[model samples]
Target: MNEKSGSLIDSLERQGVSRRTFMKYCATLASLMALPPAVGRAFAEALAKATRPSVIWLSFQECTGCTESLTRSHTPTLESLIFDSISLDYHHTLQAAAGTAAEAAREAAMKLNWGKYLLVVDGSVPMKDGGVYSTIAGVSNHDMLMDTVKGAAAVVAVGTCAAFGGLPKAQPNPTGAVAISDLVKDKPVVNVSGCPPIPVVMTGVLAHFLAFGSLPELDKLGRPLAFYGETIHDRCYRRPFYDQGKFAKTFDDEGARQGWCLFELGCKGPVTYNSCATVKWNDGTSFPIESGHGCLGCSEPDFWDAGGFYRALSLPANPLHVAATAVEVGAVVGVGVALANRAGKSAAKAGHETATLADLEK
Candidate 1:
């Protein structure tokens, strides 16, 4: 069956997923999202009984890098998440069906799961000349987006293009490109913005939705608070060098070899909010700054149009103080969680029922 409406556990079991593996996957998702350990079991239980979610992924003016990044995730591989947990009925990049067959699959999925399927979009919608700049099966990207979203339970704008109008929306603005949010005014959207957003973060959003039947808490920009709460500078490995006003003047400078801050070289870490610093990439190997490169701030809205690359941004009047406050923000979340835990313990004799940020680290 292309789309399963049966118990999810049975579906997973048929796909060779063990009960223990499913439970562990749920636990990992809980930890990844900074939820209590108990929540993992709850998630497992809920997801087991839940119907496998039908997903319809639309690709417009995109490089397909977002799908590539998602496939490279190691721990929770793309196969385990997409094939086992959800029915990915349509994704031009990954699906074998083509042309008419592909469009038919999408329409069938939408018809079967109307007002229930999760819509995942990964490109900017060009409204220029009535969206003639981009099309899928001769249907304008704008029209397709408008039509598909009407039945989506929730929409996930997976890359900066879909979330913030990425490179397509860059200066000159020839395409009249706009984000999915611009047209998806009625449905709740979860934006995961990056040139290619972190894979774990992408899956985490899907996991949250599957387990809870709702979207996770979002920042003002519609990004998940759990992953996009802190600025890259706050969690960056080279942040200490930034605090000391130490930076690499040029690519070959001693500071560069010493792994000093790259802010002077147009690192947008200080202003960009993402998990690149903390989660790293390629299975936690390293991020851009670790490899002696500056952050391009690909995660932020209008990053491409902000200014040219390799040019230092106008420094904040008290940049160090601001960075210091950013670091303190995590400590505050931990402290608040601790205080709440104490009160809960005192009131109900339940010891450490909630997972604090510190606890989640474990």
Candidate 2:
């Protein structure tokens, strides 16, 4: 490693991390982001030379679930190495200072790192009744957010609350809770939307930004495409069951015990886009589907108001159309699997027979 890289390595060491471990982390991040091996080296290089960007984390009308999710991210260590690596200037939950002192520290960091720091926000901003629903340090959450975001280089809305108003914005929303995008219009914003976003996804977004000095390209919903590009159904292990029309009708049905598809049980995996099926949780141990539970589509907009969790999705009108039931989907998948297996066998036999013909002719 070069001098700049050496300095970065030293910093990591001071933080109780080894150079080899840091490189391994870069490699893992690169693979998850679908970058080439060379890109991993580049990421390490960037992280080594770049100055730690100041981050200001704001909390509002939320349950602190987003913070809980981030803290629970499954990295190499129990403590969050990624979050600790950054220069977190202000966080109400983590900071040591209290009252006016903490507020002063936030203002100082904002001014000093103006247009160069990052703004991370959780929860929604109440817009009704002149934003009186939530307050911080004698200021409304709306005002504090606006003031903090004005000079930020970029903003990351860290949960469904900050991204899509979450539970606070449910029907007949009394507080008129609004997402970060609804309030901050000038800066580039990245929304990590889930009831509480996956911890890896949260850190991955930060890692990407830290490595590239810019936010990753996002979908229409301001979610990073690397993690939210494909629907959960596209990569689900239970996909075969769905295609075969096999399904679990109830929580304790035969199909449920057999690990059949959960479409009939109100799984929204087909419509929800996330990396849950692939990256999974608790160190890639299992996702909701793998545990025999259907997806709740928590990452999508207005998920809280999306109706019953166990209600089945309506299928097409045609009789030939596959029913949305897991059993039927599994049966259809079984037929497809059988045909594919036969085709493979036939191709192998043809190749073997052709070899004999060629030898005889020679």
Candidate 3:
């Protein structure tokens, strides 16, 4: 099948997708990319004319969890449909052609789209013993990545393994696994670093690329700021509890039952950055914190070695300068209280406005 022969709109229209549906998808993509609302229409027009870009997906020394996260957790939404719009020429896990045929397809796509294709990697590359630990068609993963990325326009590291070495590069480091950025220096690399990034986030990145012909603005970690800009703690619904110093001591405690902060129970939300709290998983059902568990900080680098999961970040310790510590805590708490008071007042005022004049006169 000639996957790259037509524009995305052509493919969608052929697939029975309405123009309105496509426009809505484009708008959603715009919102996900944090682009202004006006850009949504621009995105629609650009994407309609944009040809489906050839994509080469590479997997190395890691589990297929990232792929599962992208495919399994969501209903067949427009985001998943967008995947169909891209000419995903290579993906060992999903491709029908196997072995030599698959390898031939990848080589052909790379040759045809050289310097214009997107190379997406989902696993870390093993660098030990001439990269013998992981190989495809007897070709070392490290060598394949190096050779493949040479002609690529941009490389997207799709999971923690591809972005930060992940569990494979954790303590002991048996495979000597390294992230894509460590090896691919020439191409602009975007890291979507999560144990398995949110499905919409995965598609959003691809959509942004398709609409803008460039990667979205990224943070220091090479992760798109639209998705990884804020800490989970900052976005968590229970964050007010943290500011108020109301925390759950035990999993089944009243505070926990009341949906108070889980910081005392070893939540890593404060340090973790991802769209889980907002974009969520399982079709926007709930995230870990919403399910009453603390964040595992899976999105950050070397999270596997970030101490015990059950150890709280705010553990009390004897401070040499108690006065200084108290002052800092007081300032934070004061700000929290002020914000809470303001929110409460706003809500109360809104409620009062809803009262009818007839009731007021009575």
Candidate 4:
């Protein structure tokens, strides 16, 4: 049955997926990866006849949000089906096997598909005291990762925890947690990082690998450049507002109601890089900014320590220092403006008065 199920086309047909739908999914993945339209056709052809690679998912210190993000909101969709179609030999959260049987299954799959299987890990591995903080089947996560990565074709760190130590590695970290890269030096490790990474981004990486037999081009942080190449602010709907310096001082203010920039409210969109603004969430309904909340910078490393969410990044940490600096700048600018403007002041005032949302509609 496993051999018969190797063909993705046969499996999809059995699941009642039409060829048209499959092709559409391929096109979507191609676009997500920033590949040309021709590559979409190539992706379809490659995935249709290719044999599914064995995948072993290892979970350590995490909230299970990464799995939830990928599975929820899409019912029998192509993305979910593609994930299901993969030869997932072992996953602690989703696997039916437990105890000795589960461990045996993992071992069998590793040995059978050695040097060709994919190793996916979520959550950080606690390295303190022989990794006592997290263990599976009496084996430390550290040991398991080391053993598994050696035979795997590639390693994908799925989520901020696995990629960058996330919350578990936050200040005063008790577990002495570290990311997967800290341990795996030989293997090519792709970091799909977010508090819970975008579901499509996760699958897009998989699709690219399936079609090309290698991982996509990555950024310096080991993130797929297709998704993490641009700052969220660069693609945000409120980008015009940001350019015009029209900012919302408070959540309930008129500027906010008008959908002005949330920078003053500590939006991390400018500094944070992710596909949130473009791809969005909940079936493209909205993202956090569209839902009237400033970006929490969930995708960036050390976001938890980036300071208070409500405090603007431009402001100094010390209130007195910020006040004094603001006053000084204001006085200097005011004097300069007075000295430079006479008849120009009237023209500037007129221009300012005429400025409206229409001026920055784009």
State the local distance difference test value for candidate 2: 0.78
Error of 3 at 75 (Å): 2.4
Using all chains and alpha carbons, the TM-scores for the candidates as numbered come to: 0.82, 0.84, 0.85, 0.86
Give the poorly placed runs of model 2, Cα more than 4 Å off: 1-8, 73-79, 315-362
Candidate 4 lDDT, tens digit per residue, 1-362? 75546678778888899888899888887897898899789888988877787999999999999988887875566778888889999998899999999999999999999899999999999988889999988899999999889899999999999999998988777899999999999999999999889989988888888878999999988999999998887799998987676877557779999999886666777777799998898877799999888887878776776666654545344121222333443354433333333323454467763322212211
The TM-score of candidate 3 is 0.85
What local lDDT does model 2 show for residue 281? 80
In what order do the candidates fall by TM-score, top score first? 4, 3, 2, 1
Model 3: how far residue 320 lies from native, Å: 24
Candidate 1 TM-score, true structure as reference:
0.82
Query: Whole-model lDDT, candidate 1?
Result: 0.79
What ranges in model 4 sit over 4 Å off?
1-5, 317-362
- What's the distance in Å from true for residue 215, model 1? 0.3
lDDT of 1 by residue, 180-283 (tens): 99988899999999999998787788877877988889999999998889998889988888667676755776888888877656677877889898888888
Every candidate's lDDT: 0.79, 0.78, 0.81, 0.81
How does model 4 score by TM-score?
0.86
- Checking candidate 3 for backbone clashes, the offending pairs are none
Instruction: Kindly indicate the candidate among 2 and 3 with the higher TM-score.
Output: 3
Write the number of the candidate with greater lDDT, choosing between 1 and 3. 3
